[model samples]
Target: MITNDVLRRVRYALQLNDKKMLEIFASVDNAIDENYLHSIMEKEGEENFVFCRDSLLSLFLDGLINEKRGKKEGSSPVILPAKAILSNNDILRKLRIALNFKEDDMLNALASAEFPVSKSELSALFRKRDHRNYKECGDQLLRNFLNGITERFRGTSGKDA
Candidate 1:
């Protein structure tokens, strides 16, 4: 479940307009219209807000907001999830859509990161399931990919990792 505050923060962080957000939600099957979505965003009454079920709102908030609780706040700084970092499924889907990179890009990212798996194997894995099912090699592969991406960011300081 996504709290209203979290949603507002994510909306600001992503710099997304209601229309863009509605499109993203609609693409994910949450069929909300733009006007109502906008109204929801503008409404200050948190209790009155209606968040959708399995609507990707949680995922969006998770991937976009970095929770920062200060020392004076009486709690440790919690790393809020970003809408980009929502779930493995969300992550994979976002990556696929954002990069629009062909198979070579995935392979290059892996290889550049020193991952041992070939592009073919990775492609096969992607084909096998909408989300990767890691029994043995899966976790390692994911970790390696993550490491590679981190390394790439370290080098480029680019957005959209």
Candidate 2:
């Protein structure tokens, strides 16, 4: 559960103004209105507004925005400081685990989709420093890789097992 302070903080971190926040929210499909977001921020707070940390994460993942806060110095202006925890490795790890695949298997799947990744490369991808590299793979490549994996693994499950 995020507090109002946290919500306000994230907005500040994004360097977003009220109008820009409204625009960003509006851009998302089926996203709540400005008032709805405001009310949530007012009531439940930032945590409530963010149902999927993964989505908020994707914005960072795509390099579309930064998620750091500014710190004030002694009687000086705010200094932008980078927050060091904005990677989507957890999401990737979870996806790989759900598919019941090892790093090599995922690499193979990615390769099958023309991603041509190696186990070592895959491991690197799971690290924070490789975010820029992963972003370069673009959403289309990631989507294709996911689609291929799910398609290949679709019928390998048994219900009530």
Candidate 3:
């Protein structure tokens, strides 16, 4: 999935305005320019559509964590990996943290999207790559999860992210 699209969907789901979006960027010390923000939000093939990097997406997620769940006091800042890969699993995990979803909440979110799964399957998504039970989250799964959460928070799933 496109990182820009993920950011857009998250924005819609969270009802983030331009100023708030900028603030999210600033949350990670990445205060983006207004024009750049618009470009990032622009749809693909649209004029001035800017590609959103995985690192930026990760930063946004971190900022989101700070936005939704208050930043922990006295906690050391995390050093982002050198080459951030915003995989579906990573996206889901970050979202789970940002939205403060518990096990049942995560399940319910997926279920709300009509994409039910066993607890073990959900756990596998967060497992290390070397883990035997590790499962790679599919695009469909992430899409449905995002839609479901949109419905849960925004009162409607709206369109695809």
Candidate 4:
């Protein structure tokens, strides 16, 4: 899935308005202007639909971590590694940290979207890339997880993944 879709889903899942969206971006010291944000949120083929890049999404996720888990005291903020690619696994990992979800919580979240998964399967998604048990997270899985979050937090699964 595209980064813009993830951004839109996350925004809807948490019911964040424009002001809160800007604040979330600012929480990690990347203060995105409202017009830029507006373009990012625009659908494809719109006059000003700008593609959301992975690095920007990474910063947003970091900002989300700060917003949900509280920033570490006296510690400077960390930016994404220059060579890092923001994969679906990374996105899920960041969400897990921000939400303080346990394994069961994650399973429940997945199940909430009618995508039941086993604990061991879920664990593989977090394993190191070179590890024998490592599993790449697919777009469908990520979409389902985001949909699950929407179901849990918004009490409705109205948005398409």
Maximum-lDDT candidate: 4
Q: lDDT by residue for model 3 over 1-161, one digit each (tens)?
A: 88998999999988899999998788777889999999999999999999998888988998899989998787533546877577999999999999999999999988988899899999999999899999999989998888888989888864754
Please, what is the TM-score per model? 0.38, 0.36, 0.92, 0.94
Clashing pairs counted in every model:
11, 0, 0, 0
- Model 2 stretches astray by more than 4 angstroms: 1-86, 128-141, 155-161
- Poorest 10 consecutive residues of model 3 by lDDT? 75-84
Q: How much lDDT does each candidate structure score?
A: 0.47, 0.44, 0.88, 0.90
Ranking of candidates on lDDT, top first: 4, 3, 1, 2
Q: Which of the two, 2 or 3, has more TM-score?
A: 3
Candidate 1, TM-score vs. the true structure? 0.38
Candidate 2 weakest lDDT stretch, 10 residues: 61-70
| Runs of candidate 4 exceeding 4 Å displacement | 81-83, 158-161
Give me the candidate number with maximum TM-score. 4
